[model samples]
Target: MVRGAPSGDLSGKTVLVVGANVGIGLEASKHFARMQPARLIIACRSEAKGKVALAEIERETGYNGCEPWIVDLANFASVIAFADKFKREGGDLHILVMNAAIALPVYQPTIDGWETILQVNYLATSLLSLLLIPQLVAAGRKSTVPSRMVIVSSGVLYWLTPAKEIETSLKPLETLGSEEWCIPNHMQSRYSESKLLNLFFVRALTDRLRSVTPLSTIAVTPGFCYSQLRRVWYEKPTFSFVKIVLAIHERLLAWTAEQGSRQLIFAAVGGRDDEENMKGGFVSRGRLVEVADFVLSDEGHRMQDTVWNETIDILSGVSDKISPIVRDYLVVPDSSIN
Candidate 1:
């Protein structure tokens, strides 16, 4: 049942998809182009690669409304600049897809001083999302339909628990991203933990925004798909036998990248009649699904707030402007959850 989104017109909406040059990001961008949004911003890591994606989309869909922008998730400065640029140039944001992520075989700290996976997947992602919330709120309030924010996560999260070291730390996200706290044996789980953080963030954001405006923020898992996301397994040195096993295993079970992208499209604009089901929901292969048992657990709820507060504290420090935006737009976190 892997397919593009069902017939839907994106005529008035403005859409942005990050990490759109390859893998699911690329495929989703292509599909979005066909829907013909008012504007389609393809945010990539570099200008050259982004232009290539833009060209391909235009050629494939004959959609002239697409533009390419560069934003590096590892660089907070870059993310801030892109947000400022988008706001100055546009009125209200409609569809925002936070689609960029990384899976590294080892812990490598970025120049920004956060471990690569945590920064790209969570911290910087949160930074960008926070900066854009006001615009989302504005668009949502004016329109009868809810604006959409899709946080791409993975189902692999069901198989992970916070490493004891990360769990014991007072700051779970900070510890998970800190080189000093990295457990030698825990490197393999970093990617999975990052996805868990996404789900936590979606729940936190959705709960806080319920009364604020017409916005639906949903977390989605594209399911295991054949993607360049696992390039690290091929690029970095490992036992040849191990590489063979990983490759074959994925080849046998994975969906095509295009197949995975459909779920993203479905999340972005699907469920118009049942928008309530999508608010704070998770979807797989275009169907609404419950989060894992742990995500619905009492402890999981508490941990999500911890992650949200720490995220706000860290991101608020990045720019003084963030404080006013959060205060003016987003409602205060529900005390019941705290």
Candidate 2:
């Protein structure tokens, strides 16, 4: 199907799939497995689920080098621990797919007391990627080719709150429950806000990486695949009917999870070595497309800088936490020559 991948032969690369336990993420793990990569790490929230998912991927792809790493993307402490563990274990990484997320049923706070969906879907991802930057950079220096950062952002970002509405202050979701706080009726809009952040974060990182490193960054939507994430879009009885419709819809107009992986495949290893052809771009419907929102405007870059600086301020303790790990993991010389 979908003519396989352009070159599904990752015989010597290391791919790390966030949220590899389910949905499009699981499918991505299988895709990487088929590429016959040297190592496939399924970064998952649950150890048991990760093991089972790994087994299934190996069974399906006949590529047995795949393994799993426990990671909870919602909590900052957990992310720090995961990164430290990777460094301690000498885990070299090539590709980092920021794919795991939490969808709120009713608004709640994460363990660190931040809004759940935004915390899990955006802020935590930004932090984890930053923490792993040293390792990623190390791998890139060692690689003979360009390494990649495939940020799985959303196409729906174009439809949400305008770039102007993203407040600098952390607003409480409880404020929205009041009748006076009404701007609209849908809470789903908050999820949209988080997706919008994904775009801004990637854009900011893209610019920073363009100046500092050769490791390319590309943000892309995975099209619409059938997954647990659809629970947010439809209700139960409606969900049943919607599934029936979707089954027929797929028969008429949809791609499988494998087909949907094309954008990522291309971003990771496809395309010619042309800077204009790739890098700091967004992919959708299996093609490199301009990010279609005010987020891509000049004012958009200003907005991104503001948000990014504020984010760095908020996550100030991150790099400091890695310092201890670096001390422990680095091979200190016996003595310095005077």
Reference-based lDDT, each prediction? 0.86, 0.69
Winner by TM-score: 1
Task: Give the TM-score comparing model 1 with the true structure, all chains together.
Answer: 0.95
TM-score, cand. 2 vs. native: 0.82
- lDDT comparing candidate 1 with the true structure: 0.86
Candidate 1 lDDT over residue span 250-324, tens digit each? 878889888999999999988889998798889897889888877787777878887888888998888777888
Model 2: ten consecutive residues of lowest lDDT: 329-338
- lDDT, residue 78, candidate 2: 87
Off by over 4 Å in 2: 1-4, 167-186, 210-212, 232-254, 275-277, 318-338
Q: What TM-score goes with each of the models?
A: 0.95, 0.82
